[model samples]
Target: MGDTLIDEPTDLSVRLATVFSQMTRVRTFRLMNSAERGPWPALLKAVFTTPSLTCLEIWESPWRRPEEKFTIEALELPQNYSSLQRFVYRVPFSDCFPRESKSYGRRDRVQGSVELSNLRVLASLICDSVEVLELPAELAFLLTHITYPKLRVFSVQGHEPLQLAEWAEILRSARQLREVHLQTPIGFTEWSKTSSNWIESNSIPTAPVPQTHSDDLIMRGLSNLESLTISNPLDPGKELFFQFLPYANLRTFSLKAFPPLSALGARWSGIHSQVLTSSEILCILKGIQLINLSTFEVSYSVDAEDGVMLSHISSSFPSLEKLEIHRYRSLAKYNSEYDPLVSMPDALATATNLQHLMLNLDFPERPYWRDDNLNPERYKVFHGFLESQVASPFTGAIPSLKTLGILCHDAFSSYWDTWEVSKTRKLVSRPPHAMSN
Candidate 1:
């Protein structure tokens, strides 16, 4: 596809119509920045009208703002096109439906809009067939406007806080949803108590939906989830997360501490305290038993008590097969006695069913590589440190363990060295590195 093929040429519409009409077998289409400036009515028409198209992605540059002369596209969608089963639309930096503005005493029209009528038609065509959907939080209104009867996977990334009612409605309508991934903003917001629009639209006079507590609504929505991955800094949201555990039927769960902002204006002192703390993690695994959970990953602040936490996890989830633990801060400043690498293997000794494990930790000491100098002897000592402190201990602790990876990170680079356990009960590096006699 040349730029001229989709760019604003005089015969763009006619050319697109002819070209797309012949693409009868086209199953996926991606419309990006090239189509941001104009509605390209004919191009959109071709996409929605394609009988075999199963996926459609419409995106705009994350940093691109609407131009001064921008006009909202008010094009109508075709009556029916059920072949589309996946849709992804992203406008991370800009609003999807920009509202009208008044500047310099002059009123400006809305920059982007999804008319109600078009949403209705889109629902008829898409809501029934769309099994996977991804959108930015700014366009969450679409969830209320459109009902997804067969949706199974949903993902959303937000630039701001998303209200509770919106979250409830998403799970309410998608009754069969199995997987949900949410990337929330830095700070958490309280879920709103009520939303007249969502309530009245679905409520009936004779038997209105019960006006239960907002927490209950969210709890019911999470009951059927099999896998849930949340990326947040674990602010006030961690309290709400505690409520979700009992109701969720999750088989895979990942809780990542979303990194705090490192921009100049941000405080470096406060940022170090942002990662998940030892107490917070222990609180979660204390009394709760995620029996069905097989795969787990978490990012936490490194401390001496990490080994204790890992032991708790092994006992709590006996069916564990794959596990990954990431240390967000460096161990370079800490003394060797407090090094997690030494105690990690003995800690996870209870996970007898475990087959694979990965640990991402900062180096105990800064390597000379930071100065652009590589010493084979220094690397050998580091390899020996792992063979004795990590690999050798792990080989005897867990009989079922087959593969282990020690990902060491420094200021300069990350090296993921993997060791394969042989039947002779010995650990050998897959890609052998320099070793001392």
Candidate 2:
């Protein structure tokens, strides 16, 4: 077998077939943008022949469309499509047809039908449209009938508000689903004054439920989920902000944004008007038993007091081992000595189990402060708490604290230099000692 490696047949189909024949435990097949569409028939033949094959991935570039080259008849798969445990099909924006109104308008109608008929064996499905793709209507119907007993993950990406009712139906069917990612615009209609709730409509409403409420519905469906990542934070409907609390099983959550969080929140009346207070944060924390939660992260552009709201989060999550705060800047108005440093360490000090703490601090420049003033007297109280942990006479400050990272903005880099290295060293070297009154 080793000697055959060099002398293997050069013909692509023959080589693929030979490989399939030789590897008995072949479990994965990944097709890149360059995979020839003309050879799909032969590829399917090889796949059916390989009894151990269970996973297949096809990733096409935005610039190329392998599907365009082959007619449906020429690309038929073997009856063994059901043998696969996982299948993924990705088509980048560049690969999609140009946006002609006639073509774009009907694109979903066309592709939805093909997806339903062809990819019936998938236990797991992921589709992405970076530029923009109109998902076909049949795509919804296809999802409704598929029985993925072992299916646990589903993801779809597109710009248009694809049918969400289909998604609700799919979620209702996917008993084993633990994670779902939707990268498309979610569409819902507001009910007339008589209706108690906004209802899912067949057509996009004149004005859809602000992205906030849509996010709520999506979150509600995935209540039993353990992890979720939503790339377009702006698109999550406003009504769904509190939906996360009920997902007690959640261990990890992530959000990426094209538009700022403020703009996203503006779509929802409740979150936009007020900052998250300590009481509200406490309530959210009280709802979930986070003993199993290992990671929590949120990135938003809000006032300093708003950032302080996170301090309330530390005490409630006792089992939290890793924490991350991103895109956070200090509040400007409370730059004086009277303002607190959010006192996050006070709450964190209680989490003897915490091992990693990551804070991304972005403070704006003020005329009264110099570059070397990042950790000025105002931060003294917070720093005092940190110092006590190092010298912690009782439990030894952050006994499990092995790593601490503080990322500062460039504008404040100069402020760090003003600190006397020797004094700072002595401060940290000294073990925790009870302060004398």
Candidate 3:
């Protein structure tokens, strides 16, 4: 049946444009192929209807009738979501299309490409105004050609590390970017050179090193960058890791400190047996002078000296509001399974401005989800970890703390979490603006 929007246009392009124009109020759209129906043009039309829509998600089915061919790029999309703020598109990589991966079973549905003919148009339109964007790792390069002047939060999925120079060059214009996250956990590998374990190797051709960033250059360039996260582990002492510190406005920062990787690269390498230490923290803080720094998070293990480190953190950012110390891969091959978190540092007690605190500690009691019996011995361990050792400092360190989050066994015990929270909350005093203030 011919619809009014189509105006009985004989040309397929005109008909599709007609559908897109009529989608005036449609804001949230999901573009995907389903087994019950092949949403040829109707589902795709959902792309343009909403001018005021703020969120859009696009996904493609991995299992489809092998013989069925799906095409997405039917026309040069003419619409743009100038007001769109968040866009999540998990398009299958090119390799996944037209060919089934080893993981796909024999009973798997047909494989085909979501030939969104003009993906560039979609990327261009959203890239302009999107503040928080999560897109396929395959299409992340599209950001290179487009400018996200308003982009504030960005995350890419692919494992490949964006070269330091390329990342810096592209972000040169993203002055408003407060958070830049790279979420490549599995497919990515990082081999960084630390000052302690650096051994210059000549076997691998490493990416060229980026030029050093001076104080003036860093401040003037990415001054607004605050929170940065990367799934790929980092070398704390490496120059690339330090290059991100110019954000005078930095408040929250998280990085996964991975062990030295033996990748195909030529740089100094050393036997790093330590987790991120307080010394590394001080080094970074000293350079950036992040007076407003609030939350500092690191993954992986840590070096000794919890006392001196925590003390510096309190003095460094008196305005600190939140502090988090999570053990990244607390258990690994070379890492021990019985490994426990470091004892609460006494220095933490001095973070007067701290409001929210999260620590990876061994909690008391057992989780209800599992069949394991409650360990009575955990009682001593929990209190000893939180109270006897750093009772005075821990309670006094963050007078402003409203929430104390802890991950025991690097997980949660629904049964005990509620009580632990209540117990800890009462032990710590609240600020004098206490109830009303």
Candidate 4:
């Protein structure tokens, strides 16, 4: 057992190499240590011997440079690395290559120059920062030469924005490339200025790309894509949505730090009559169903009226199986006029297909007025709405709802307790026809 255990890695490596040789679709090779370089040549021999490897990922620890510091690019890929379909490298930028080395001109060039002829998918290209102003020429050349016809996913993280012409050409070249995630942290402000010109010149009049002005480039290029996620927190306004709204094929969409619904309404005023109405929301829902989207999520900070508008929009998505509504705490001020006990029953009544529902009612735990000391007239109005109107409407409307989650702020625990009293009333008054098994 001891001898067998000692030989396990060798045995495994041999078995992996044998399997790698026969693979035609997918392959992965990972390494951990960089202190010892002697074993790499043998590993490379095993990796290169397989001519059909389509996916490759190499991870190595920092390598000791001649200057005695560890560096990236220490574990250089072997030459003749053909047949690679996707390649990923997750090594620290600070540790890989020397800052002065000309060989490490730009990441794209480094990737493009590799002998991975059949490469199709590239993802998670991590760098210290991304530039959106001046992209490296070598990287641009590499992007132009790399085969993208068969590529399905591509993600780049860096500060530089590839030249506008280069990006246009890339969009034109990568016909089959579908999913793209770009993270550019720098030069966005300057880049935003020329974004309009770039879009006009490219004939893709989408929103001004924030930094790299690549937003339009991305939209134009990934025309056939069905899923898109943009993480730009700087500009989550309606203009961004308008720019990409033409992509009727999108089924799954996500935006981080999106602007308020009112802002969205104001910016698209001309199209508001066409796109922001109930009919438009229904059309988007139909599109989502046609594309087979089962999950939809939208989180933003807006007022109660905006929430109402959003709810109306959500009603259009009849096929949605799971829905998550995240109301920011910042919007709590607008809840001053909204009585939780009354508002919830109506909202719950409308979401008939909801299998799971989460409502984060951002209210203070204790109302300024105690339930005992509450104005008799206001209490009557609130209680009347819950008892006579809200609870009665819920019986037949939410037949399909299985799970309901209610989250409240710590300060609003007392108010929630009062809200629970309303729930008790609901159970007691549940019509015989509304009782679930």
Best by TM-score: 1
TM-score of each: 0.69, 0.53, 0.59, 0.44
Off by over 4 Å in 1: 1-27, 30-42, 48-51, 58-76, 90-125, 188-210, 213-220, 233-241, 244-248, 259-274, 334-338, 364-392, 406-419, 425-437
1 versus 3: better lDDT goes to = 1
- lDDT scores of the candidates, listed in order: 0.58, 0.43, 0.46, 0.39
Candidate 1 versus truth, CA RMSD in Å, comes to 8.1
Worst 10 residues of 1 by lDDT: 101-110
Q: Write the per-residue lDDT of candidate 2 for residues 1-437, one digit (tens) a residue.
A: 11111221337666777778778888777666542231245565565457677666665421122243333344355332346656556531221233432222112323333343344333222221111111222243344444445557766543323345445545555656676554332222331221111112222233344555645555555777776545444343422433443556777654423122222122111211122333434444554466567676545444544434565456666667776554444455534434344344564566667666554434333222222466466455544443453223212334555445433223322111111113123323222211110
RMSD per model, one decimal: 8.1, 12.6, 11.4, 14.4
Q: Compare candidates 1 and 2 on lDDT and give the better one.
A: 1
What is candidate 1's lDDT per residue for 309-424, written digit by digit as tens? 88888888878898877765566575375555667778889998998877666555635341225566666777788777767788798899898887643343444578999998
Q: Residue 47, candidate 4: how far off, in angstroms?
A: 3.9
User: Ten-residue segment with the worst summed lDDT in candidate 2?
Assistant: 412-421
